[model samples]
Target chain A: MAVDTRKCVGCSDCVVACQTENSVPIGFCRDWVVEVTDGTYPTLELELRSERCNHCDNSPCVRCCPTGASHYDKGGIVVVTHNKCIGCGACIASCPYDARYAHPDGYVDKCTFCLHRVEKGLLPSCVATCPTKCMYFGDLNDPKSPVSIMLKNRKYKTLIPEAGTKPQLYFLI
Target chain B: MREELIVSGRMNPFIDPHLNIWHWQIPLYLFLGGLAAGILFFAALFYLRGKENEYRAAVKIAPMIVPIILIIGLFALFLDLKHKAYFWHLYTVIRLQSPMSWGAWTLMIITPLSFIWAALHIKEVFPKWDWKYQWLKDIETFFQKYKKVIAWLMAIYSVILGVYTGILFSAFNARPLWNTSILGPLFLVSGLSTGTATAILFSKNHEERKTFARIDLLLIAIELFLIVHMFMGFLASTQVQIDAANLFLGGPYTAPFWMLVVAMGLIFPAVLEALELIKFRIPVYIPAILVLFGGIMLRFILAYAGQMSRWLY
Candidate 1:
């Protein structure tokens, strides 16, 4: 995964792209562009970063879920099945990043990496919709996958490396 | 404050958030659960001490009370929380700094222990019936062999469970009423008094009584002394805490505090104890039930009314 923050605007196109594709529930955005700006007027520097479910190898949410509603499939995408969920919002409170929420109907929902489209050999909606082509997604193990090659050559970091979640999303600063 | 959230003191009509209501309800249920767990553990402790007089009643009720208390606590917590959907989150947390976190952890451990203890009591009662199901029979025998070990652990756990409720509130530094160090000891004493009182009230006739009124008399006496110490500690603590002190001492909570806590909780129970001292035959159950009611009301009033404090002068 590659995130080129430079030349990238916080337009939330990835969020719209996700909602258009999945028809995600209202108020539940799979992708978010967080803007951090400090200082006043000319002294201010604005920075933008796109965030979503990182699909960590050691995902805390899946392990903490009692009903096994929130889980990671074989392909390493974190998934939530509405039917199996008992609406306990345990996942909502468990996520330290505040990434998940209980849908108005009581089911917990979060980013899924657009696994349905990925299965059909298409990039995630975020990667596909990024006008500046700042975001990249590929297999980490291939070494030949653009993500692995770029990660090896570029100075990039994952969100919350301290948590040791082993997130797949990488950021290029 | 947002225009929509403009809270009015006099006309507000208790429209507080559901989560706040749930917080109070959770502690109430926990106090009751802790009391039940404490009484059962105390009974088991007496049984292990070769009190043949107490062992029979312990064997009969010790295991049964916990599961009932736990079941009721769980129901109240879920109902009070309103949205049943996020209820699972209580089990998913592991934050040690949060008292609610400790409660979830302790309740998890106590729940299974109570269930196993209950199963063992059943096994003890129907040893011959267990022979029909070999696996169950084997499990029963295993638990039977380990009853003493389980009883001792239950006693230790009950102490933690009883006082932890007080510690849970005291840990929250923002609430002056709960922030006092004495609250933990106060809660523990109250837990024991309520537990002993409950046991006495529910105990059978003289032949199989689980509680001796003499013991409850002593327990209530000690509990009242602890209550006095707790108030004194709060009163002498700090001027910043003065408003809350006023609330309990001679303010909004004074009437319930006096009628319920002073009269019903302490005086009536003490009168029962005095009757025992004088060799007068007074039914212990009446005072026991009243004190138990008074103790529960104490928690209810304190938990809710305590939230009204503010730093704004």
Candidate 2:
């Protein structure tokens, strides 16, 4: 996933789209927007971007899950098997992104990159519904994919790279 | 330079304020698990050293409550699970790198062994404890025959259980307050101190109480040293880790952690125990109760504060 920070306007259309699409319980979210303001008044800078599970290449959540409920699917997307999860919250604590939440139905819930839609040959609801088209989703493994091309053409950074989870989400600067 | 992050559409209850999924249940469970492990470890150690007759409280009396403590601790863990029905999944596979997996398996093995170990000594504690069923009698006899072997196993598993209670939290690399190797030893020593305090409280003999007080004092010393070392490690590490150290230094957790856990729990009890050791008059129950209080407080502070410590703003 690639988020063009310059293009995102903090509209939160994607957040609503995700909630309506995924049936995420009210008061909880799998994805959200963050507006970062940096520097002094005259030289202040603002960056708005949507954030969700990074689906890290070396995900600590999957490694720390006691029941193997958290595991990587094809394309390195992290998914949690609801039935297998003991809802221990080990994965929740292990996530540096703080991307996971305990569902009211008693299981850990997080972004799956809309795997259900992806399997059906569609973009994640958040990406598809973005008003500004700032969020890009595609196979990072495929060099020819739009997300890969965007990464190659732009300066990009992953959040908290020092955490060493090798996060897959990229923010195009 | 100033920076501010205003996040919208970020209302996940626990994560929004801080990581708060683990609450009282986890800390309570850890304290109980550590206490049970401490009691079991001391019981096995004293028995193996052929001092069971001298340390009857440690070997017999204290262990008699282990089964109950463990069951309560397991219940606390079970309650903390969101999907309580699927807890059986914890046993279906083993992930060696996952400390929670190790903990689940350790609890499984040790819980049953604790019952058996306690059951084996029941007859000694209560001479009238007759096995009404023939199968029960046979099981007791079988355990008696291999009591020493069980003691050895319990000793090893108890250490694992004790250290594991702490390792479970420390395993989360994301939480800076808990991401340290010292937590394992710190928790183990604290468990031993609390366990010895319990034994002292139960012992009717002055000599037995004196022996446990001395051991408890030493364990408290080691615990304080490890805690100081942990703070130094945190302070000397990355900015995030230094931020974690500040939680106890002067952050939100300072007073409770310093007053309740360190001063009231470890230091005050150590002083009382020391005074008792030096022939000063002090009630055995005072320090014992204080140590036990401190043990649980330590877990509560760490669990809560660890959740609050994170790399991301």
Candidate 3:
């Protein structure tokens, strides 16, 4: 996933789209918007971007999960097997991005990159519903994919790269 | 200098301010697990050293309580689990890198061993006790024949269980406060100190009490040194770790951690034990209770404060 920060207007349409499409319970979310205001006083800069599970290549959640509940599906998407999860919350603590939450029905919940929809040849609800067309989702393994081209041509950064998670989500700077 | 404000629709309760998923149950479970480790370690250590008769409190009496403590601790853990019915899943697969998996397997092995160890010595603790069935007597006799082998295995597993209680927390690198190697040794020494305290409480022999007091004092000293070393390492490392150390340095956790865990738990108890060693007429229960209190407090403060330490903020 690549988010074009310059184009985001902080409208939160993706947030609504995800909630509606995934039927996420109230007071919980699979994805959300973050508006970062940086700088001193009047010399300020704002960057709005949608954030969700990084689905890191070195995901701590998968490594730390006691059972094989949290594991990588095809295309490197992290998914939780609800029935297998004991809901000990180890994955939630291991996540640097704070992307996972305890589902009320008693399991850890997080973004699956909308694999159900993507399997049927559709974009994720959040990417499909973004009015600004700022969110881009595709296989980074594909050299001609838009995400790969964007990273090649534009400056991009990942959240908390220092943690060494190798996040799959990128923000175009 | 730069500042940032994050305005979002992200309202996940525990994740907003910080990660706060673990609660009293986890800390309590760790405390009880460590305590069980300590008791079993001492029991096996004395048995292997041929001092089992001399340290009856450690080798026999203290172990009698281990099975009970472990069950209560496991119950607390079960209560904390969100998916109670699915806990059997923990045994379905074991992820070696996952501390929780190691913990679950360790508990499974140690819990049964504790019951068997205690049952083997039930006749010694209760003079009139006997096996009601012939098969039960045969089983007891078979175990008693190889009691030394059982003691050796128990000693090894006890240390693993002790260190594992701390490793469970330190394995999570995302939480800076708990992401240190020192926690394993720190928790092990603390467990040993608490276990000695329990032995001291149960022993009626003056010489045995004095012996455990000296050992507990040494263990307490090691625990304090490890704690100071942990903070020093934290302060010398990344900003996030420094923030973690500050939780007890001057942050909101300072009072409870410093006063309760350090002063009351280790220092005061050490002083009392020192006086007792010198033939001072101090009641044994006072220092024993203090050490136990401090052990649990250390877990509580760490579990809560670690949740408050993160890289994002």
- Candidate 3 regions exceeding 4 Å error are B1-6
Q: In lDDT terms, how accurate is model 1?
A: 0.66
Provide per-model DockQ scores: 0.04, 0.79, 0.73
lDDT winner, 2 or 3: 2
Error of 2 at B86 (Å): 1.1
Ordering by DockQ = 2, 3, 1
Candidates in order, interface RMSD in Å: 11.3, 1.2, 1.4
lDDT for model 2, please: 0.93
Per-model TM-score on C-alpha atoms: 0.60, 0.98, 0.98
Candidate 3 backbone collisions, by pair:
none
The DockQ-derived docking category for candidate 3 is medium
Supply candidate 2's per-residue lDDT for B190: 91
- DockQ category of candidate 1: incorrect
Tens digits of per-residue lDDT for model 3, B1-313: 4444445567797687789899999999999999999999999999999998899999999999999999999999999899889999999987898999988998989998999999998899989997899999998889999899889889999899999999998988899999999999999999888899999999998889999999999999999999989999999999889999998889999999999999999999999999988888999999999999999999999999989988874
lDDT of 2 by residue, B1-313 (tens): 7464646647687787789889899999999999999999999999999999899999999999999999999999999999999999999999998999989999999999999988988988999898899999898988899999999999999999999999998888899999999999999999988899889988998988999998998899999999999999999999999999999898999999999999999999899989889999999899999999999999999999999999897
